[model samples]
Target chain A: MLALAWANLTHHKLRTTLSALAVGLGLALFLVSNGLATGSIGEVADRMESVQAELLVLPAQENMVFSGGAVFTPGWTDHLASVADEQGPLATDVIPAYWSQITMGGQQQRLFGIDPEQMPLFLGDRGMVAGHAFEQATAFSQRIRELRATADGQPLDTLLDDDEWSAGLELVIDDRLRRVGQDGHPYEIGDVVRVLGREFRIVGVVESGVAGRVFAPIETLRLINDGGRQRSTMFFIKLRPGLDHLVAARLFTEQLGSTVQVQPTSDYGRRLQQELGKVFMYVNVTNTLALIVCFLFILLTMYTFVLERTREIGILKSLGVTRRGLIGLSMLEALLISSAGAVIGIALSFVAQAIIAMRLPLLTVELPPQHLATAVAIGLVGGIGSALYPGWRAARLEPAVALGYE
Target chain B: MISVRNVQHNYRHNGVVESVLHGVNLAVAEGEFVVLMGPSGCGKTTLLNILGLMMSPTSADSVALAGTETLGLSDSARTRLRRETLGFVFQRFNLLPTMSVRSNVALPLRIRGQHADGAVDKMLDRVGLLPQAGKKPGRLSIGQQQRVALARALIGRPAVLFADEPTGNLDSASAGAVLSLLREFHRDWGQTILLITHNEHLVGAGDRVLTMRDGRLHD
Candidate 1:
């Protein structure tokens, strides 16, 4: 019976191939779109968790974490350091950081301004991929603060009594920026980048996707905000290695009062992932529609095939083939076609991943074996289910009328 | 053996009733070779259809096959009876075009849940189609296709073989060859055959010949 079904399908080569192609196309679209959705969301979650700090000092206002993130003053960095745990300090180290969007060479890039002395504490030696780390001098930071407080840039000479203070404006760019400045102009370690009318030379380029693509001194970011602003967006609290962040988060929230928000790192990752999930609803809808279109394509193809084979069905009936046998043959035919199509779709998905890598570099797609199995299973169910009606029609053919059909 | 009495069939077209067969009676003894001949629009094909159980009569006084009453059998019962007792060769040969010649011959046995067990090869060999067993019916000539149909009909060793103008679409040489093969089978196997044709030259090959007209058979 299976042999007969196969022969019949192969006999009508063009029709069978067209139907299989329709099924393959549907499965391929379904796989590629879903993979893209999951991959893009996973990338965002990865980048967010890459931050060095395990504790965030957000604003006390609830839901403000996603509203351009919660902002607080750089003064909070001092308070966090002043607190104590059973160990020497409540937190191992503290960094006052500000994230601001700045256009470099006509493209927006994330600029993280951290205290230069603690760049190793945040990013370690990997942060200094090229050139050298910032020189460890307390006066260099104090000089930038004094210069930023004054209304005019001329106060910088008076504030910086030491000639070496001029070197404090050095920048360490992320490797992502070193490549092409996040799809903008390429930059070397010694290149100069101007942000908000101030020039800072790149002293180092860090690995991509680990830290911010652009890094400057905290006082420099404060100056970019406006003279005498003196405020930072948030305070980053780095916990001791192997220390529980949850315990430190609770300690900080209790000691800092309810006016400040302290959140563990894991919760932030979850919340951001939830945001990405909300954005993926549209892709899910498209995947559903694509599968439906695939189902309809197969259904129409099988129906027309049965119509064309009506006379053959009648002949089989006259040859003493039972209705169940006839129906079984049709279903077997459809299943074989569907199974072959799903395999092709699986192969196509691999090509889709490569295409995504080559064309949409920012988006990553992971086509796990389980995902491929799911696509194949759906194709089987869709293709076989679509043929049931046609099988019934073929089985129900009247031998008397059909034998007479031209 | 086959028997039918007062069997009538009707067709309703455009709200008008047309009687195609009226109270037709037929009986062919076991192993008897019978030929039925008639002009177009006669009830010869209808009678053959009833004997083969491919069509149910609107009403029948009595219908029995192999001494068993088959008149009121259910549809599945009728299909099983056809599978068990009857084999047919139609005007167009009716071979599945996509199937190999041997597969076509083995189909009925497969449907009966019985392994063909070399019966297909034996029948094909008898029909001189052994070399072409693996070829599809479409690859064969019309006469070759009809012989494959003939081999397929007799492969199950059915009790009765019904040939309804089996060579109607063939050239004269092929028709004569088919009739000769039919004669050889009857002579060697004492196989019962009911052949229907409008060709008078084919009538003499049967042990008994009859003509049908106006919904009735004449001796």
Candidate 2:
């Protein structure tokens, strides 16, 4: 029986190969699409949790970690700092930051305005890979103050020389951004990157997966974006070593009223998934449809194959091969094809991952084991399931009638 | 051994009943070689099908094969009976073209959950096809393919061998060769043979000959 099934498949090589490839392509699409969705969300959550802060304070409506805009004031940070001084154990440090979408080197990306002096403390043990961490940011802030005092409120870019402007707004980018520079080249230290409509030289490259891809000094950004009103969109807070962040978050929420949202950084991944539940649902629905299409394709292919072998089936039946035996043979063929398709799908997923990594460096693509298992299961089960009707039809065929079939 | 008494069969198509076999009665003892001679559409194949347990007659008093009453047996039971007691050769030589000659001959043993145990090679040697065992049925000549089919049918050592115009598509020499093999198997193993044919010249090879016409049989 096994020999006969194998022979039948090999007898029509092109059809079998095409059928398997169709199934393989469907599984690969499901895997890679789901991988991208989960991978992008996971990447953002991981980077947010790596910011060295136990908690973040944002405007009440802002639950997503990467949403960038000037939504509140730096006065909130001063208030948090005041509380840290008073409570002693409830809080230790508060760092103000501004986040916004800005174009750099003709690509839109997230930019975080972090305090030059406190950025290192907030990033505890996360060292830079190239140059220094905002070494001239303090001096640049002082220069901005002096220029504001003397220039009668002239635009900052006009008041300074090109080199002075570059020095005043130094940029620090993550290593991922460095891989994709203007004109298909990689960025390096001392290269000027245009951000927020101003040229700022890249001073340092930090390890990826911490905060936004691009960063600048808070003082300069606040003065430019907030008109020196000392506004900040969020504040990162460090806690005493043994404190429960959930309790701290509840306390912050109680004190800040309905205008602020506080959450522990560690819970960001789960929270982000909840916040983007609809996106994930859409992805799952789309992938399931792809699986169904693959199932239907196998069904049609196997059905046609069985039809073509009517006379052969009749011969087997006449030779006393039971209906059960015939059905088993058909299902066995389906299993073999599906198993081959699953292997092809897995290989194709890796190829897809590599392509995505090369073309879009910042977009992480994860091939989790469970997704692979699910894809293979779908292929196998679907193949068997799709063969059921065709096999049954073949089994139910009358030997005399089938033998007479042209 | 085969027996039939008052067996009848009909096929209905588009509200019209076409009777193919009517009250057919026949008996062939164990080891007897019987030839059923008939014109086309004269119910010879239908009677063979009923005797082979491949079809259930619309009406029958008794239709027994190998001492078992087969008229009302379940499909699986009939299938087991067919596998255990009978073999068939068809006019088209109905060899599975996808399989090599040896594999085709080994099919019955495989279906019966028995290993070939050199039976396939032995049968191929008997059929003078040992050199062609590895070749697919499609690559063989018509006569060779029929010979392979004959080997497949006889390899299981069935009690009854049913040949439905086994040499219908063969040349005279090929037909003579297949008929000789059938005679040899019957003489050596005492295999009960029911061969159907329209060729009157082959009637001499059978121990008894029955003619069927218009769904009725005559001795």
Candidate 3:
């Protein structure tokens, strides 16, 4: 029966191809939208993990901690430090850092400020890939030493060295800094980058694994914020081994008494994800409606195909073909149409994703195994459900009347 | 052998039930060549439909084929009987247009779930359409398509063959050729054949002639 159905479908090649194309377009939209929705959620989780912070501290009144940008008095850091120092059973180290977006070299980069001296304790064996750690005693020693060894000694390497005498600002750009400037080498360590009419020397280049980011000294970041020195935007704390992040977060909230929002790393990330998910819910809804509409279209078209072939069905019936056999044949036809559509749609989606990735590097569209499985399941369900009414009509047709039809 | 007893049929049009076959009874023995002759509205086609098992009377005790009773059979069982014991060639040459000539010829075999190996070629050859087997029915002449339909019907080796004006759509030459082939097959194989036609001139070749008028068969 399936073999007969297949032959019939192929017999009308043009109509079959057109019908398959219609189904394919609908399935493509469904698959592409689902991939993007899942990808956005995954991207948020990935960004949170990259921060490597066990706990996050933000202003208490902040409803959306990830997006609203934490704003609190710099004195809050001192309070958190004192609380950690005096703790007996649940003592932990708290590191305070400030973060904000800044425009430099005509591109937006996230700026991070950390106290050089205390950073190693938090980083702990995680050293920089490029420059050495900041040394306070000989803070200006390496620059002066390298400058004196140059042939001219005329302060020609002034931007690379001499951060104290030239300006207190220092820029730590990411590996993507390679894209800027004529030489395609946008101001390496000790070179100057002008931001908002202020020139800052690139004291170091920090290669954070995630792309499109930059970091600077705490003092330099304060300068970039127009002398807002005492305030910090975020406080990151690392817990001791075997110490639960939730326990540490609870201690902070208890000590602060709602003066700030204290949340574990995972919880904060999840909250951020939830906020992002709200924006994509509309997309999911629209795509779902589109898929439903597509299912209906497939049903209608396949039903019409069956109707148009009524005489043929009648002939088969008069020839001793059982009702179940006829139904099976129609279902096989439906399945062939659906499976063909799914394969074309999924293949086109992969191609589209690849093309978009080339244009937008950050857009990662991956069709996982579960996604493929879902598409196939949708096809099967669509095939069976769409064929039911048509198959029934064909099965119920009386051969005598049909044979007499013109 | 085939027997029909007191069979009646009617058509309803806009609340009017017009009787077409009124308690008609007829019989044809094995190896008989019977021709039914009638005017357009004389129920010739309706009688042929009943004889082919394509329809059943509204009220009747039995329409028997060989030794088995057909009136008590279920719809599917009747269909099986028709498939195994009957073959039909229609006036319009109702071949599936989407199918090739070979496929159309092999349709009955396929429907019976029989192995179609060499069956298509043999049937097409028997109909003298071997070279045109790959063409669709729509591409063929009315006579050629009629031959394909004949091949499809005869492929199952049915016990009784029912033809309703089988050459009505053909040219005179094609029509004569088809009629000659039918007569030859009937004579050579000793197969029972019932032919319905309004053209009384063709009745001379049949072994028996039954004329129908006003919903009754005349001896």
Candidate 4:
């Protein structure tokens, strides 16, 4: 029976190949869609957790992953530090940070601004991959003072040359940015990237997922925001060892009142996942549709195949092949075809992943083992489910009538 | 061994009743070779079909194969009887084209859920097709294909063999070869045979001959 089923498929090479390809295409679509959904969300969550913070003091009513402009006054940094000290030493460190998006290499890149002195605590072991961290705080202060002295109550750009102003500022960028632009060239150390109408030299390249793609001194970001506005976006707090983040978050909420929302840093990933629930919903719908398309493809293919083999089926019945045996033969053919399709789908998924990586470097496509297993399962279920009716039809065929079928 | 009495068959097409067999009766003892002869559309094949358990007569007083009553049996039970007691060689060979000759010859036993245990190879060797067993049926000549079909039918050592114009599609020489092989099997194994043919010359090969015309039979 197995030999017969396999021989039938191989004898009709074009038809069998087309059926397998159709099923493979459907499975591939499902795998890529599912990969993108989980990949993007997982990347965001993992990046958030990589910051190594215990709690976050977000601007009131702001729960999104990305928001533009400064939302908290710079004075909140001092106030939060003072409050944490008074609240039974609730936190060991309180770091106010600013973030904004900037366009570079025709892509929107996240830029985080942190105090030069506090970066070591936030970065942990995922330190610079090239060059060095931001200069000592005193050196940055000295540069700011020199800029003020040269400005003499006028715009710094007007007072100094582009090279002179850019030479004094430094930017620590993510390693991924090293290979930017359509040319696929790397941005080496000392290379300048223009942002906010001022060029800043790249001082270091850091591993990705350390808060943002690019990091700069908070003073430099403050200078760029609305012509040196005195405001920050959020605060990252590290609690004292053995302190419960939830309890500390509650205490901070009370101290700051309703002006700020405090939450454990661990919740950031879960929050982002919830925020993108609609993406996951769309993936699920597409996955279902893909499998349905596969089912329909197999159903149509097997029906036509059975119709063409009516006389052969009669011959088997005449040879004493039971109805159940006929059904088994049909199902076995379906299984072989579906197994072929699954292999093709997995191969196509990897090709799709490569293309995505080449075309959209910023996007992450994760082909987890679970998703691969699901794709294979979809193929088997779709193939077998769709074969049921056709198998039954073949088994139910009257031997004499089928032998006479034209 | 086969027995039948008062067996009738009718077919309806497009709301019109077409009676194909009327009051047919047949009895062939074990090891007896019987030839059923009739012109096309004269119901020889229909009667053979009824005796082979491939069709149920519209009405039958009694029908038995190997002493087992066949009428009133379920379709599955009839299929089992066909598998265990009867073999058939159709005019067109009816070989599954996709399978190699060995696989085709091995089919009956496979359907019975029995391992060939070298029976397939031994049968092929007996039919002078052992060397061609690896080839697909389509690659064989008409005579070779007929021999393959014969090997398949006899593989299970069935009690009765039904040959419906088994040599119809073969040349005279190929037909002679097939007939010789059938005679050889009957002579050595005493295999009861019910062969249907329109050719008068082939009638001499059977122990007895029966003729059919207009839905009735005459011995």
Q: Which candidate tops lDDT? A: 2
Clashing pairs for model 2 are A73-A232, A74-A231, A74-A232
Q: What stretches of model 4 exceed 4 Å from their correct place?
A: A1-22, A66-70, A85-88, A105-107, A116-124, A127-164, A167-172, A177-180, A183-204, A298-310, A404-406, B3-29, B41-47, B55-63, B97-99, B213-219
CAPRI tier of model 3: acceptable
**Candidate 4 or 2, higher lDDT:** 2
Better of 1 and 3 by lDDT: 1
Better of 1 and 3 by TM-score: 1
Better of 1 and 2 by lDDT: 2
What lDDT score goes with residue B18 in model 1?
Answer: 90
Per-residue C-alpha lDDT of model 2 across residues A1-406, encoded as one tens digit per residue: 7777898888778877877887788889888887887898899888888878898888887757456453775467667755532446466888778876787545777788887877675456677989878878878777776776777766654676766655667888888888877788888999986676667889988887777788898766765677655677888888877778888888777777888888898888999888888888997787677767767766776677677778888888888989999889888888888888889989999999999988778878789999999999988888888777888887787788788888
Order the candidates by TM-score, highest first: 2, 4, 1, 3
TM-score of each: 0.82, 0.88, 0.76, 0.86
lDDT of each: 0.77, 0.84, 0.71, 0.82
How well does candidate 3 match the true structure in TM-score terms?
0.76
The global Cα lDDT (0 to 1) of model 3 is: 0.71
Worst 10 residues of 3 chain A by lDDT: A135-144
Sort the candidates on DockQ, descending order: 4, 2, 1, 3
Tens-digit per-residue lDDT, A319-344, candidate 1: 78777777788788889888878988
Candidate 2: tens digits of C-alpha lDDT, residues B1-219: 788899989999999999998899899999999999999999999888889887788999999999999877888899899999999999999898888898999999999999996889988999899999999998999998999999999999999999999989999999999999999988988999999999998989999999999999999
True contacts kept of each: 0.47, 0.66, 0.51, 0.77
DockQ per candidate: 0.55, 0.71, 0.46, 0.71
Q: Distance (Å) between predicted and true CA of A83, model 4?
A: 4.0
